[model samples]
Target: MIAFPDEAAGCPLTGIVASYTPRLAALAAEPGFVAAVDQHAAEIRERLFAQGPELMPRPLRRAELTDYALGFLDALAEVGWDQPVGYDYAVDRLTAICWLVHQNGLLDA
Candidate 1:
């Protein structure tokens, strides 16, 4: 099994979410920020769940999340994406994914 950072401590995923806290806080003054995050979370959830004729939410194996996260980071690197000093959609999406992973206890798997 791939080892993930300890969630209780300072996981990189958690840190990523925390790093954007200020931006999110500032953006909270306007509408749509929370909605955008919720939408991102839904997207991440779809990626993490099995897709088929079933209607229920069947979570894929934990390894899938690891793969998804690594692939995302890889894609960012391939595109020369850098974390901007200001609000960035990529960072927000990643933060949402991290939050989902943490909330779903995928890090422990």
Candidate 2:
């Protein structure tokens, strides 16, 4: 498991991953899982960057991840989502986002 800094532990995005890390790790052992997660991360990264320059004029930094995670949660709430008993695309994407953030050293930035 990636050990984020103490400061990063309080981040909502970190919390999101904490909930799913066990499953994500198991999935990582499967063939092609890493690639799929990477793809999802790429998609989400693009979406974040696509936020108008006025709102995100610079590349996304670690500090911005919390806001992004909150926005994602808000959107899920808006759509009336319920946590699934099994894996789903949202979970996969979120796990992927967490991995992306960790792998890119964003949490430490």
lDDT of 1: 0.62
Cα lDDT of model 1 by residue, 20-93, tens digit: 44555544575566677778888877867767787788764556665676677667778888777654677778
Please give the lDDT score at residue 19 for candidate 2: 66
Highest lDDT: which candidate? 2
Give the per-residue lDDT digits (tens) of candidate 2, residues 1-109: 2223342544676666566566577664765666667788777777667566476544666656666676777777787777687656766677786876676677563
Residue clash pairs of candidate 2: none
TM-score to true structure, per model: 0.66, 0.65
Q: Model 1: which residue pairs collide? A: none
What residue runs in model 2 are displaced by over 4 Å at the alpha carbon? 1-10, 50-60
Task: Report clashes for each candidate as comma-separated counts.
Answer: 0, 0
